[model samples]
Target: LAKTTQPISMDSYEGQEVNITCSHNNIATNDYITWYQQFPSQGPRFIIQGYKTKVTNEVASLFIPADRKSSTLSLPRVSLSDTAVYYCLVGDHGGDTGRRALTFGSGTRLQVQP
Candidate 1:
């Protein structure tokens, strides 16, 4: 597992675009970057994942550089409900062979105001 670093906090207004970046300089070849969003008192929800290049979904887009040292989660037209703590995790998806460990950082708190 590679340790990740993210902004402690971010501010955005409704209908604005918010980009949160995570740094994982020690990432391994088998490692993948996964982003999650979580509200207060709730578990993290999967946003997107990528090994290299860019990946986009209905909710957000994940951009990873060729070196895989960093990734950015882009949320377009965010609303008040989109406010939450975003987490970036890096690990090898060691398939169903056995259990794997997941380490979480402090997470980036996104505040979406009106």
Candidate 2:
């Protein structure tokens, strides 16, 4: 498991681009960067994922540098409704017997203020 570092909290207004960065200094080669967003009481929702380079989707974009030590989650034109906690998880979600259950560490709390 790769340890991720993220801001404990963040604030933003409506219609703004928000970026949350995560650091994984000891990330492994097979580790994949995956991000999830959590609301007040619901389960975390998958946002984006990438192994290396950049991956884009309708929701967000994941940028992983060559060294794979860190990753960035970019939200374009964020709104107040997007306020939630973003979690960065790194692990091999493949069919590895002991790797199936990855622990959920801390997550980045994002507050989109009106």
Candidate 3:
């Protein structure tokens, strides 16, 4: 597993775009970059994922540079409901045979001010 570093907090106005970046310089070859979003007490939900280049889903877009040392999660037109903690993880996805517990650290908290 690779260690990841992200911002502790960010402030954004309602209906504004927000981008959160995470660094993982020592990522392994089989490791994948995944982004998750959490609202208060709820469990984190998958936001986006990318090995390289850019990956866009309904909720967010993940941008990975060529070096694969870091990634950025882009949220368009964020609202108050989007205020939450975002986490970036770099690891191997254990489908069934390789199941493993996730190690979580302090994540980036985004505050949307109305």
> Highest TM-score among the candidates is held by which one?
1
**Clashes per model (N, Cα, C within 3 A):** 0, 0, 0
Candidate 1, residues 1-114, lDDT tens digits: the string is 899999999999999999999999999998989999999999999989988999999999999988889999999999999999999999996877746787999999999999
Candidate 2 stretches greater than 4 Å from native: 94-99
Q: List the residue pairs that clash in candidate 2.
A: none
Compare the candidates by lDDT and give the number of the best one: 1
lDDT of 2 by residue, 1-114 (tens): 778888898899989999999999999878889999999999999999899999999999999999999999999999888999999999986665654756577898899988
Q: lDDT of all predictions, in order shown?
A: 0.94, 0.90, 0.90
Cα lDDT for residue 43, model 1?
A: 93
TM-score of 2: 0.93
Task: Show the colliding residue pairs in model 1.
Answer: none
**What are the per-residue Cα lDDT tens digits for candidate 3 across 1-114?**
889999999999988999999999998777789988899879899888789999998899999999999999999999999999999999876756888555666999999999
Task: Tell me which of candidates 2 and 3 scores higher on TM-score.
Answer: 2
Ranking by lDDT: 1, 2, 3
TM-score of each: 0.95, 0.93, 0.92
Model 3 worst lDDT window (10 residues): 95-104
